[model samples]
Target: MHDAATPSRSQPITAGVLTALVGFTSSFAVVLAGLTAVGASPAQAASGLLVLCVAQALGMLWMSRRHRIPLSLAWSTPGAALLAGTGVPDGGWPAAVGAFVVVGLLILLTALWPHLGDLIAMIPAPIAQAMLAGVLLSLCLAPVRAVVDDPWVIAPVILTWLALVRFAPRLAVPAAFVVALVVIVIWTAGHGGPTGDWLPRIEGTVPAFEVGALIGIALPLYVVTMASQNVPGVAVMASYGYQVPWRETMTVTGLGTVAGAFAGGHAVNLAAITAAISAGPDAGPDPKRRWIAAETAAWSYLVLAVASVALTTLAVSGPPGVVETVAGLALLGTLGASLSAAVSATEGREAAVVTFVVAASGVSVAGIGAAFWALVAGLVTAAVLRRR
Candidate 1:
């Protein structure tokens, strides 16, 4: 009964489904790898994933409901990468839990203080856009990289994506995801793809605070989550002309992070890459209707939270880059838009370029990632060249 003038269900359906698929496929492995590296057994890692997914779903629901924007929330992927490299704290996973609690408290502090959110919001628009481009640079390369490594599996997927984009833009990412999923299932049928349990195995640990974990894990995790994830997340929304209320975004995620830690989840923050996906025109031709896409994403996140065990099993068992390739392809449009925004204003062009390069470099100092430095570099460049 739907005509061309009437909205296609595909818009919301694809937006929601892609949001969930991208959330799971892209960085779930990085999170799992991080948890395991921190001395979490299999059960503990799965538990962490489940709790984080649920936490993110809750944050998304709250934010989207209050603000009416497609504001997506996610666990800190860079923070997880940090944990993977940061040696296990002295008291093991329990110590890590305690560190998570500390991070939650710090996040809460900013949420309660309007000025803190304002401080983050005050970051120049071009630099913010550049930082976003930098953060997403590596993940956006997966589609091409996959062609080099596994062209047969990836070629059909990308082809389908390209065709859909040309003729059926709304369904592009979702269709690509379906294609990728089928190929993974068929190829991994007996190939020993990452195989294991996919059941919600809740592993509870009493938090044990350690000074070492606080300084090494908690502080750095807090910084990275704030700078790399939350800050850029705000930027992505701004790029699309949506003004997200930073206070609500921070308060909900901060509290959610605190609650999720008992269940072994880590820092929860605003999503940077996926936000662009949901907030963009692909979610819907009409910007007003895009919030529906975020609402759909919230529902999908909750569903995935319940199915975290199964999703984890599939993620670990997939062909090495299958998930990442899909993630990159899905995000290509957003990346292009971000690049355009970064370079659009000649006034801040030089600063934005420095920000993009440094942020893309993935350089870290004292365990802090480059997103913050990218902002700093861009700001300094702007300041130094102000007279020119």
Candidate 2:
């Protein structure tokens, strides 16, 4: 078993900053996309996302210290989208919150029954990777579309980001986003755009209990959060050699989701792509020290959640083209790697293909989202074709 002393040299400040920034920025986009799709006013959606970011960051810190592992939590992107598409219509934010609490409890229960974790482990790595790639493909495309619609706004940002990533890898991700934001602000100001309502404004709603709401919103939310977000997130951590207890991690994620829901945040879970940053060598070569960084991220998230409404609004109301482009560019590397790994795994190509296609197709049934369906399809296909 690893101990904190093992990573004594890894400084908390740098690791925490990087982890928080990556988590906040990457997940924030998906939150906005979900909100926009659901017809949430820009301000309301932004506030909700900020609450999520804060909760995830805090959860990451608490769990990392408690488990002595670099565990990071995040809002489930696919789950958020699923909620946007189906959840709001069923019972709105209240039902979504109820679902989050239930899921958290379920995750905690899984700790007592290791079989659930074992069941998740049975999923083939390649297929899991393929599902991740499919989920991220749309995110990668956002920047390109943004550029086409507003080349003057997005082109320079992308170009500058690419150049920096190639030459100054450390600054590439954050710098690109910051630069784009600055440019956007200047452009908006020049055009006499609205600035008074730039930041997110808080508007809290109390959750109400309803069985139908639970069925329509909660169950599906739990299913997608586990299948699409948590499953792949665990895989990413494993790939980086972090042998954390799956049950505990899930439990914490569930708890974070519960906390976030009270504050209007949607589903929170383990992060897949962004988790790679801290899990890998970038966080630190020493495994133990990385926990410190993770702790810091969690603390930062808590603080952010406390101030969610404002930060989220700023992110949302800001220049859309710039933010979307920066987000896509930041994820470019992770997306490429995930896709390659998915297709390359032995005995997994067909399964991976099935997962990718289904997830990308954006189809849902009985309120269940595409991620769950993708895994089902891939597994079924793999089983059927095995005898051939």
Candidate 3:
């Protein structure tokens, strides 16, 4: 006889599938844009996307089954936004790859070194969120520009996203992506159909370290991924009565990021928003059974990996600003949340505002990007204000 606690099989599975759909469809364009901004070609960017999926899938599956916790993993969407804002470093793509590797190593260090983790935690929350908001500011403007530049192509996607957000908030971004995909299809058909090599493959890069890339890209990426994704992910799961295996979780994600970096991927970390779907009551009445939702999402990510090449082709070949509109729309929620958190507290509001302005300026000094400078500026301001 089935255990009395066991509920219907489909509930967890459906939640798992929805988790994957929302996670992938919502922010992939941002990933592609980030990789490209940091010097990846279309092929390399596609490879990065493929490897990120495979790596996170493998990590999530192992961790969820090992701990029997609903542990979902994801590529760092905030880190991607940081990249989109950072532009290319001194040594270009290889330098960017090297920066990615450094981020992974830093994550590993965080797991092994308690002090390192504590140091990250010591960073003022307002400053960190302000930095992320600054990084995302420019990308969030894409939809507005698209509406002005190509209203006909962008109007339907914006309308779809708005409609779904009202009734089905979780599906809003994915629905926008669907509309964008349909627009791409129609645009492609008119432009003589899709054209490109559609077979998914990993394009390897030999990482080359440079001081500018490390300080500019690696430091900010690590901070954003930790502050925005990993830390919040743990808290989200904890609210559901699950204590994530911190060491094991970090070890797995760190290793996964390291492995994916060689294949042109950026970073992978714990899921924030999507974790609630897999860990929440909707997955099942019994908390023990919720891990299945994570497992299911992992498998779903693998399936999506196969379509990396096709999706990359469509995004690249689509009408100008159309895919960007989708990417921008996808980040709006994140930007709003970050901005709210940044300015919500009066204690550090001045420091946080300074961070946001410096980051949004997109300034580079001594070859380092605004993200790093923004953090430095915020911390200094906070320290000065506290002293006064």
Candidate 4:
């Protein structure tokens, strides 16, 4: 585990490839759903996915090697949840794209100002997790809604997900995604003359800035990505004894997000859950060697980027409830973790509960969504009720 190394150094197949595979397969459906939820067309969605992968791959590889740590990168799933849960602005998808740019800039700002990270860190963990819980609650209900409305199409997907969750936990979401696609293909084939084009189509959208979208979408996206994704990403590395140059990595993630959003992608940030897979001892006996695991992720992500775009096409073209159903199944574990974290602290339990309820309600006032209000309400409550 030397700080300095040479090109002749070899990487292991076991750690590197497995981490990449797990990261990609586990969450790509949710990424697709998030893009679509914000009104991205199929082509635009593919562009976003492709851009996100390539940017994260390049950024993560460079950072990990520079620091000699497994500095993995991932898109913000919770930010996607926020997008999925929010209503689009009058300015349309272009406006949303504009908001994504704002989010990127804000991330970059936070990186430069350590005080901003400190403010987010000051928020109770419970409240932050509660806000995320609220954002995700609706998507979590999607599977149930699909079952009640169309059991036949939705049943197979749910059953497959459940079976995999029980028998092979890590593969559950990816298998569910596969089941949804197969079900869509079979149903389409049975009903009519071959479904529409299945090939990936990449399209670009020129962003148009809108004030409403900046407040409603961009602000919340920045807050959640910083609090839920990047902050935790830092903690995960540190938990495994890695010294993260927080400012440098955030600059990379922030810049990466800006680059990706130009092609309609949402926010890219530190990999929280997946970081452990690469940073842990299992990545290799020598911790320095683990950055190879992340470097492999970079290469694998580029390879998977092609398939990711194709899968996005399939998910968007699938049956009505099918895509959301797959997305819900994919995020189930994340939802559980958020819910658990939301209640882990007793002092802020009531405030966090308020935050969760308001966020889950999807209330919108003056074009601003519940995620913001939930945070406000919870913070005020926590302040007022202190010592009670």
How well does each candidate superpose onto the true structure, as a TM-score?
0.68, 0.76, 0.97, 0.91
Model 2 C-alpha lDDT versus the unseen true structure: 0.67
Which residue pairs show backbone clashes in model 4? none
Question: Taking the candidates one at a time, how many backbone clashes does each contain?
Answer: 4, 7, 0, 0
**Tens-digit lDDT string for candidate 3 (139-168):** 999999989998999999999999999999
Q: RMSD, model 2, all Cα superposed?
A: 5.2
CA RMSD for every model? 5.7, 5.2, 1.7, 3.7
lDDT-better candidate, 2 vs 3:
3
Model 2 lDDT per residue over 1-388, tens place? 2577445455555677677776665445556666555435566576667667766776776778777877877777666545433424445555555655676666665667868656666777666667666766776788889888888878888888889878987567667766766676677677665443444455455666556545545554565567667777889889977876776676667676776666566677887766776677767767766777677777777666555554444455556666667656765775687688889766768888998888777665665556567777888888877877
Which residue pairs in candidate 2 have backbone atoms (N, alpha carbon, C) closer than 3 angstroms, thus clashing?
7-289, 54-301, 54-305, 57-298, 58-298, 61-298, 200-313
Instruction: Provide the overall lDDT of each model, using Cα atoms, as 2-decimal numbers.
Output: 0.77, 0.67, 0.93, 0.82
Which stretches in model 3 have alpha-carbon errors above 4 Å?
1-7
**Tens-digit per-residue lDDT, 203-283, candidate 1:** 888999977677767765776687678878889999998997877777888899999888789889988877878888778
Over 4 Å off, model 4: 1-11, 191-202
Of candidate 3, the 10-residue stretch with the lowest lDDT total is: 1-10
**Model 3 compared with the native: what TM-score?**
0.97
Instruction: Please give the TM-score that candidate 1 achieves against the real structure.
Output: 0.68
Better of 1 and 4 by lDDT: 4
Which lDDT tens digits does candidate 4 get at residues 1-388? Answer: 4634332244433566777777776777777777777788777878888888888899978997787788889888888888888866658889889899889888888888988778877888888889889989899899999999999999998999899889998778878877887987787766662323345445678898877788878887888898888878889999988988888888898899888887988898998988887888767667767888888888888887777666665666667888888778777777888889998877778999999999999988886778888888889989989956
The candidate, 3 or 4, that scores higher on lDDT is 3
